[model samples]
Target: GLPKSMSVLRVNDLVLAAYDSGIRRLEPRNGYSPGQQDSQQFWSAGSSKCQGWDSQGDATYQVLVQEVNASAPQAEPYYMQILKTCELDDATGTVQIATRCSLNGEDVLHYRGDQNRWFSVHPAAWRVAERWNQAAEVFGAMNHLTPQQCQSWIQSSASFIAQQTAQPTGHMALVPRTEARPRRLICHVTGFYPRPIKVTWEQGEQDALWEQLSSGILPNGDHTFQIQVSIELGQEGAGPTEHVCVVRHSSLANTTLRVTWDSQPTVQTVTMEIVVGCLLTALGVGALGWYLRKK
Candidate 1:
């Protein structure tokens, strides 16, 4: 739950969890990336009907974004939906690529490109580069934005002034994994924007340092982004006892992923053997007592 003094934000990654604050989670308005020419669209097959396996159709894309106000832990989710159309000219052997980028019926940019036959860059090529640059810019911005920044915006923004602050009402409990072989655990944080939050492992209250590895953001096709954090677990014979994944937000309370060690099957079997030995000894003594009484 959100503390009385602080605010709350209801974040959604679609991994499945309940809201901690009172804010209801609403779907976003837009998240579709601009559809550029020569860009492939991937789709999942329907249950019974036919379509080319996953990559058959021309690219038609939609973007979905779900954001929470920083001050409230459980607030209604802010929704953003981006719808894009990719128009191309295949008859003339030239690519005329145009992407109409809009948010809730509002235009952001009309990404346009033309594929030239001679030395000029193709429209598709240009559009691809442009889109990449835009995504890169967003990635850059994530580093600078924090929860506190969001809290400040909430106070002045017309959209947020009437909003209720959601509190951090719940937590994520870790599902333990046990195997003798070397295994790795990877978790991706979803429903975060500007990607400023930092993820790390902690033992109780203190910082637990593991090997520092690579971390980055990947597009989920729906304008929203997923941040992936990976860690190697338990070396040979040195089992890890406890670890937690902490997500630090600027304005909202931090989220913790708590995990405990799984019980070893081998240990359980050894304990069972000891119990069986004790039972056998007891039975033998009972038989001896009965025989002596009969004599």
Candidate 2:
């Protein structure tokens, strides 16, 4: 078995990498678009999903190369982290890295169990929040995130969300560079109309407070315009609740993008398990008492 301490430390290191560098723009070196290279970076670490031991008394371990967003041109774009967890099988001492590909727009497993399994994860996946534990530490270091980093996160978040919704456009945020009580959120909104639009905030169903909007026109180089707006929610209550930015476009329906930042509670849960010996002892005592009563 792997030392628990070493496993924990390895996890911490990966999480720190996630925190210091948002996972989206980080990607693996293979099967990626070079055009997107201007936006991502790479990090290598060991995987914690399994230990150095298996049921058959074989030693096994994995190392992963993770690709995350680097600070770049946009504050944030479609961000992602691709992990290729490679394992060394002690039985054969063979090293293998998992690989995946899309077949007709669907991810299908094609390799053998013995081939290898690189756990490909997306920020949009289920375990993302939990996978974020160590990385969450750097999120608090938002002040250290450069403008390039912010651009990467926002742009990447927007792109990914849009792809999921098939909307072709939307907005997202990267942690901001200030230490306010509620945390800072910077967003970039994209759409097809390419005209100046109204950006305002509404909390839950109530009217919005702390509203500010700035607008500019960007060239798409395709005879189209890219409209950009910036607003800050530097106020109380903006934290610990859900806030929606209602973007009224010149041609599209009023699109409402929501953001929520409730502080994660700092509580750890522990479960106590009894040993088999203790269980047998309790059962023996119960039987003994029953026998004495009968006597």
List clash counts for every candidate, in order.
Answer: 43, 31
lDDT of 1 by residue, 32-68 (tens): 2112322122111111111221111112122111111
Which candidate has the top score in TM-score? 1
Candidate 2, residue 196: the lDDT equals: 46
**Least well predicted 10-residue stretch by lDDT in candidate 1:** 42-51
How do the predictions measure up, each by TM-score?
A: 0.29, 0.26
Error (Å) of candidate 2 at residue 24 is 44
Q: Which lDDT tens digits does candidate 2 get at residues 1-118?
A: 3122111111101111211111212232212222344433222322212221121112111111012222112343231111223344447645443323221122322222342222
lDDT of each: 0.33, 0.32
Poorly placed runs, candidate 2 (over 4 Å)? 1-168, 177-182, 253-295
